[model samples]
Target: MNIRKMADSGNDFLAETDSPLGLGESGKPIPSSPRVLSILSSVFERSIQKNEKLLKKLKTKDNVTVFHGSRAPTMGIGQYIDRISKYTCCGTPCLVVAYIYIERYLQKMDAYLTSLNVHRLLITSIMVAAKFNDAGCHNNTFFARVGGVSTKEMNRMEIEFLSNLDFRLHVTADIFRAHCLQLQKEGFGENPINHRPSNKTRAKCLPQIAGYTCRAV
Candidate 1:
């Protein structure tokens, strides 16, 4: 068995330390530490529950179609839309803005892909947005890690999305300005160093903006 231990801000203790168990600890159960046991139990329980939920969801027709299509499919419109929405909602206003970009790009291409699949566009939008905002943070590995898709998968999706939208990236100027205005109105000063707007103020303002945006749309 391989044991790996990482110490807090210190050198990692990958090798096993001398056992404090009996001289001959053979066949005797070494009781687990309460904290360790609690953590392990919680992790196991969560994993089991997550797997169970996934299994149950996969049994459904829609989800089964998505999972199967994810592996191999030319294109299923409904499944594509579903995946887009699911992935996009996984982030914040920045993500929402990215979603808008995807939609506009698609619209400009004369691709009548339904607004229903606006979600999938979000994932690509986020990648584009992240790249636009900070190239350092927008890499294949970064997308793979954050998006929970393999680098190959992300690349494929990116190409497909771009092709569908005729390679025209249309990130709106309005969303960022709107968010900034809202933050300023709420007395959240922009960070001078990073130039990133405050998330706390944005969170507070999101509901109001969403309602207004929805009404206008």
Candidate 2:
């Protein structure tokens, strides 16, 4: 399937069937990390290629340089995400939160997500999201090894990432739902989620999803 095209087609009925899991709907389980990671990875790959072309012409670094590795890591971004999920078991909410943070930082910095910097940025953002959202999370050293970075660099990256975002990590329920909506829009194409969530008829979240850090397990 064309991963990039998933975001383009307006009626992705098949993808939508299971894609909207973990939106705190009754009987639906937490979203699958592999499925969400596939979508996120496709977006990252497209962004890197698009930014690569743009940077070649512009030839300027700006804040992007801070995240750039000494050289690009050999592992594919999808595989790297898989490895992190496999070992850390931080789950889909953390991955989605990391996505939100990455976009937030990019907007703040106007930085391009290039191949040289994407992996490092992802590792840092995911680590921060894990700490913020997960009950028991790994330390910087464990995350560093998962991302193929050193403990020292991981420490530096975490501080730098937090500093760049001004350490604002509290994602509210509405904001989280909006992000989930956007993720669904990408997977099922951009009609924009029209169904207003009702406190009216839905069952209470199995583990309480609103106004908290999305621990719906």
Candidate 3:
């Protein structure tokens, strides 16, 4: 799978699937950290639940693909996103790019995005996106620490994700703006970043069973 070919393919599919929460400095104000956190929490939870339910059905049919990984997500999605925002250096745009990468992975692999894979996927995608978009990006080891995974595991997942994406990381201006617009439409436009949830609140908000530990086979 060539990156060129994949990019040439209409990413209208992205518009159809989960759109990004928002990005850049234009659309509406960059959402406040709390608002961005809320949007990401909802998006991650929805994707995880949707995929987990799908996995259960596939398991019944003996058709589930064993995702090779080990992950123990101590932080809830919001907290994780907050950490990612700090570590990735690419900030909100990286999150937007990560969301786009997730969409691409789902389309290319024909795989469900369950809790088993979402954490690793999010970490890897954000790292990759930061490298692509940010002027000064952290190394994979640093991101791994922030993401609660080993450097080796992160490297492996990064390779797997890039392979699955056919190495396509380019987000055209149009596609990027479209995702931001969708995110704004989804209610992230103009929320101030002043109000962040406490650790207790985040813990309460995260699903009790949200954490997963995946080690590469």
Candidate 4:
């Protein structure tokens, strides 16, 4: 998106989230208003689900089998992201970085996101993002419980995910903002990618994670 240039165009701008605690392992404080995490989660989740279904459709004639080893979670993607945010104490920027990692993973794996892999992918990406972007973070064992996977499995997935992305963990601030704007555009109200929690609903549900701020681009 050449997000750096877009930032210069003045369609949108970045403002640091209120950081009473100051920046530390979590990078800047999460902005206190934008629903970027929820939007991105919805968008990414729907894209993966749709593409997985499409691939299966094409394979039906050939009798090519697809295995869905894990079931989809009861919590929606937005809610799931909220849980990750709260449990990991990752800044909102981590959500943006995690989205970037997921895109890279899909491109590299030549695979669609699916019920079997999405939760694992989401958790691993966020954990990796936090380690790379946040100054400090919890260990894999902690994230394992948060993500409903064993610590060993979470560790394995983290390695595999990093290798998939060629260990490129740096994401510029402009790119991070660009991802947020993209999610807002793509996954905002009634766009049909998936249902998104409204700002009001999210506010009540995610008091801590709701601090991220954004304006229209």
How far in Å is the alpha carbon of 130 misplaced in model 4? 0.3
Tell me the TM-score of each prediction against the true structure.
0.35, 0.71, 0.67, 0.68
Q: Compared with the true structure, what per-residue lDDT tens digits does model 4 show for residues 54-143?
A: 978888321111212335556666766767766666654556667788888778767777655666678888888777654557788777
Provide the overall lDDT of each model, using Cα atoms, as 2-decimal numbers. 0.35, 0.63, 0.58, 0.58
Cα misplacement distance, residue 85 of candidate 2 (Å): 0.7
Worst 10 residues of 3 by lDDT: 13-22
> Candidate 1's residue-wise lDDT over 1-217, tens digit each?
0000101111211101122110012422122122221222233234335654665676732212111222322333333322332322222333334544554664565432322223234345667654554434347545544444456766766776666556655443444445324323332232222222223211111111111010001
Candidate closer to the true structure by TM-score (higher is better), 3 or 4: 4
Worst 10 residues of 4 by lDDT: 208-217
* Alpha-carbon deviation at 117 in model 4, angstroms: 1.1
Model 1: pairs clashing at backbone N, Cα or C within 3 Å: 84-119, 84-120, 85-119, 85-120
Put the candidates in TM-score order, highest first: 2, 4, 3, 1
Give per-model CA RMSD: 21.4, 11.3, 8.8, 9.0
Q: Which structure is stronger by lDDT: 1 or 4?
A: 4
Please give me the total number of clashing residue pairs in predicted model 2: 0
